[model samples]
Target: MTKDLLMWDETLFRDPEVFEIDYVPEQFNHRETQMRELAFQIRPGARGGRPLNTICRGLPGTGKTTSVRKLFAEIEAETKKLVPVYVNCEIDNTKFAVFAQIYRKLSGHLPPASGTSFKQVFDAIARILQKEEIVLLVTLDDANYLLYENEINRVLYALLRSHESYPGTRIGVIAIISDMNVDLSREVDPRVASVFRPTEIYFPPYSADEARHILTERVMSGLYPGVLSDAMLDLVVEQTMKSGDLRVGLDLLKRAALNAEKDARKKIEEDDICLAYQVSKYLHLSFTLRTLKDEEKVLLKTIADMSSEGKEMNAGEVYTHAKEVMKIGYTRFYEIVKKLDAMRLINLDYRQGRGRTRVITLRYEPQRVLDLLA
Candidate 1:
């Protein structure tokens, strides 16, 4: 059997284990103090105390969720000390749904929204909490989605105000936002916004040197020795940082190792890192495309096609072209185009002192869209 034939066999591609990556912080480092302070806030409650509300702000994969979860686990260990609840707002973003989650965490029941007043929910929680005497701490992850929907203040404001109903019970919010220092008062009530201002922790991206340490830590723990050359590791880490996300770093490394292993290669080489970059780009673009609406997709595709055709079009030109390409009218087309810009699927060219003129750039190559759609 030729080595190349064994290397090219499909069996290695079918290995299910290759798809999984360990997300533990030991394999991932460079955010230690941020993790420790977060752990300190929620882990201390000797039967009764103020529930700690911490806002964790950072770009995605700066270990925000991981650090928060780690802290939650440490706090949860003291059974019956302080009740810890973690809700992902991205998945359960509605006011009723988030409140319902809080209700379930505290009451162990999922009551329907109909015929149930917020007062009723609080009364029930008060009765239960007075009986059990537990401090309820809730962590809302990816909380910006809820705030964006305007449901945050409604639900959170109600809960915070619920002290009016149950004088002794405590409820606090831990909101996570992608932006570090964005002012929410522009959108939220001044009173409600002030209550959320106590403690804010920002997680910045690792420095290039720190990123290298993180990359090395993962490589040493997860891969065989000599599998990755210094050059290969640097390339993987470099490409990962280009996305401004660390999951990309970890994912690129994992994919490159699997690519090497697939080729019947014991030692992953630089070639595998290059292949992983292409694969990661394809995956990121595919993810971005999948999240777009049909109208948004049409706008993006129209822009991508124009860019492929070497036309330097502005926002107005793009919308004008969308009418010809997708047969959509001007009114709806402009709305879809704005959404695409907001989502960052398209880039706009604007002068500092001037208004938003038409010049814009398609964020992806047209052939990439075709490959993904195929």
Candidate 2:
């Protein structure tokens, strides 16, 4: 007789939230060095002084955000003098919107949606900090978004140099940059750079063993016992390391469990993992693409289309094709190519042929990129 299928009410997850993208695990392993360094930099804020500014550089899923969140939680639990605010720059990319987040965090309400100038918001936040004697520590998660929008200088200038305009205002910033190619020091304005100097903390990609240990921990906490076999766990880790992202492992685990459940099986099998990886491996690519501007997306598509002919296109050839779809000049096209390379969407290489020609190539399968763009 056939085994009974999983009922609608049956689930393999013990705590499904543990597999979520934003879930901060209780045991954050393999990042102790980064956490300690971050804490040391932020220690001053706990004692009513401005926290040292920090720049967290790492690839996607390298525990940077989780480290900041974990530290922020510890800070809030330990002190009243320091107020920690985490602003996702992807959502709040403007100077006004950033300060508005600060305002909301301090005052327990948002500023008026209209009729409030940036100066007004800045002054209000400054007054609150000065009056309360509270040290403000803001974490600009995904801060590269601010740099792209040309608001990094304005945001950093106001936060780092606020004391010049309003005496006794203590503020610090933690800028998290996921793009390892970006040099934060070279990207900011000189005046802002002078004060915005930060303690650079690098969170390198996890080693294979570390990735295995972390994923095993997640499986134990997130799923029921006997749901995933040892062999399948190794498969998930291998795929995750291949992608160089831990989130892909977590996603693969969750998806594989679901696939098992769909088959009314208590344990995940190799087929489950193989199928889940088909989608999980591209998690980082999908997220990075979502943040690209229209022009950037168009340029990427153009490259993908050109590369489908099975030849690596040089910079000049790419610009010629890109300009037809977008009204950008060669200089701007070159910039976009560099940005895409930084984002890991494409490979940018310089060849010694004819005065250092730039070679462009897509990182993923051209058809996969085209399908996603569609």
Candidate 3:
């Protein structure tokens, strides 16, 4: 057997960080229209005025968060008058947690984790913004998570109406919702909806050609020349299009290269791409599962186990099993099912039995879900 092994010091990656999910590329392509609209809404804050509240709606990996991050970077570089604070609602889904993020951003330290009340934290954030005469531009990425916890209304109400309570506190919100099924107008409270009349920006999935161009750009910037051939790159692009997520394509490129390296090969092959996809395809699911609470994970695991055994459990049946493991009411179980459905991890369908019974099904293979959960 002949093998072309790389030197211990040599690496195919020119910059491995480029393939990271959170690494924002310097040259963002194919979303010029959305970026321009986002900048326009945020322009006022940059110029020392209150920025307009905005809604950025799109599917997962559609560049909603990236656009906001890129624009926020530019805004911060331009002036200190506009403070851009990014809150990931996936991790900070509660009102106190959300404000604590802003508090940390403004004050350069987090509020006392256990002792600080939400009102105290909110007031401190408001006072700092008002005192500094700074406009607060906050991007709530994955704001849908807040909607799931029923905290969206409170968060929005507080942010939008802060000026009413603490006069001269300028704050604007850019709520990024990846779940297209979420309608803010219907989901938020009437008071929040009234004030959060935002400029809506939609990010559609990239076209096949666009995906090809973007993936090719990453190939050139992230990997060494000749490491990924055109044919292999096309295969990666096809897989990315199938997933409808650019992150998957990036992960595929990185994973395929690693697979090639492990085999003592300088170049990635079709087999490398195929093997990498086995894990990369679940990138979204993996991320979603990470954000879930412990109880939520228990419920999903129960459903996955039953589904793996060819058991189609309805909401009540799954609730019965799930509650056995975790103490939760049926209403909470139903909400978890809906939240999981919105996250695209499961299919929540209503089948007409005695009444309209909710049938639970795993969106991915049951084994795959169980393996990931494990």
Candidate 4:
């Protein structure tokens, strides 16, 4: 059989596994304080005491999920008193699904997906915990999705009020969210809120130097020494610092290397990095846009279409024009517009003028929207 010579030749990457999002490094820099605080909050669980519920909040890619995973690993390693179960609320946002995750984690198997009611799952979990003499520390990652689905209250009630159904069963939750502006106390049930006085731990955005150091560490571990240049690394750091998302930098590095490999190049150049950045931006924006409702997407398209250079349009003007694009009632249209604004997909500026005039502008580049929607 004929073989391709490049397969056996020197490659740009030494170990591509390090570039993966889930890859936890031996040295987790820039997040020691958060990690230590997490360990402290959950230490009581090791002694059969109730661990303090915690809220880990920050922007995406700021190590909220990573920190929690690291802590879970450490907790499991140290003692068997607490069972750490992690659930991504984006997938298991509902009470039944969330409880099923806990059931699976505690019982080593999942309850029947169908045929079994939520109360059954809840009771099973309680029985197992009481019999096993284990405290459950559940981490609800991407927890903001629960709030959007209006399931946060019920989910919290299920966890915080487990003791009501089964006495002496301790359940501690670590809620991870990207939106820090959300007021958890008001959103959750009053009873759950009173009990779930979480110790909030915030993961701030990485600075330029921190981003650089992180990218440098990843590059050294993931790629060959000479495959990426210092100048090229700077480009990634520059973009990451602006976005304040370390995920972007890591993604850019990995994608650029892949693109270079595709082009039969030995090293990643500036052009490769730039191209990867554009692709990454498009992917990120498209993912966010996909999450919007149909009405919101139409409103976003209208804003991108009607917006002019160095100027914004009034909400009234955009609404009038949006009807031309997609017909809808005024009240519903206004609500979708405000929803998009809240989602940060558009810039909504309320002007102080003769009337309560609100201006709206497309937050993203117009061409990008055209490309994605097309």
TM for every model, in the order presented, reads 0.74, 0.88, 0.97, 0.82
Please give the distance, in angstroms, between residue 299's alpha carbon in candidate 3 and its true position after superposition: 0.8
Worst 10 residues of 1 by lDDT: 13-22
Q: Mark the regions of model 3 whose C-alpha exceeds 4 Å error after superposition.
A: 1-3
Output the better candidate (3/4) by lDDT: 3
Which 10 consecutive residues of model 4 have the lowest summed lDDT? 1-10
Query: Could you give the candidate ranking by lDDT, starting with the highest?
Result: 2, 3, 4, 1
For model 1 the local lDDT of residue 224 reads 57
Put down candidate 1 lDDT per residue, 126-217, tens digits, no spaces. 77766787777777786765664557788667666666767777776677776443444355687677665547788988777887887777
Per-residue lDDT of model 4, residues 198-226, tens digit only: 99898999888877888899999899777
User: Native-vs-model 1 lDDT?
Assistant: 0.69
- The 10-residue segment of model 2 with minimum total lDDT is 1-10
Q: lDDT tens string, model 3, 1-374?
A: 34456777678899999899898999999899999999899888877888999999988888999999999888878799999999999999999999999999999999997977888998888888878898998899999999988899999999999989999988899999988889876788788889898989999999989999988988899998999988988899899999999999999999999998887777898999999999999998889999999888898899888898897778888888887899998888888888888888889988997989888888888888888888
Model 1 TM-score relative to the real fold = 0.74
Q: Rate the local accuracy (lDDT) of all candidates.
A: 0.69, 0.90, 0.90, 0.82
Residue lDDT tens for model 2, 1-374:
23435567888999999998899998999999999999999989988888999999998899999999999989889888899999998778899999999999999998999999999999999888888898999999999888776789999999999999999999999999987767888899899999988989999999999999999999999998888888888889899999898999999888988898888877788999999999898888887788788898999999999989999799999998887888998878877888788668899998996699989999999998998888
Q: Output the number of the TM-score-best candidate.
A: 3
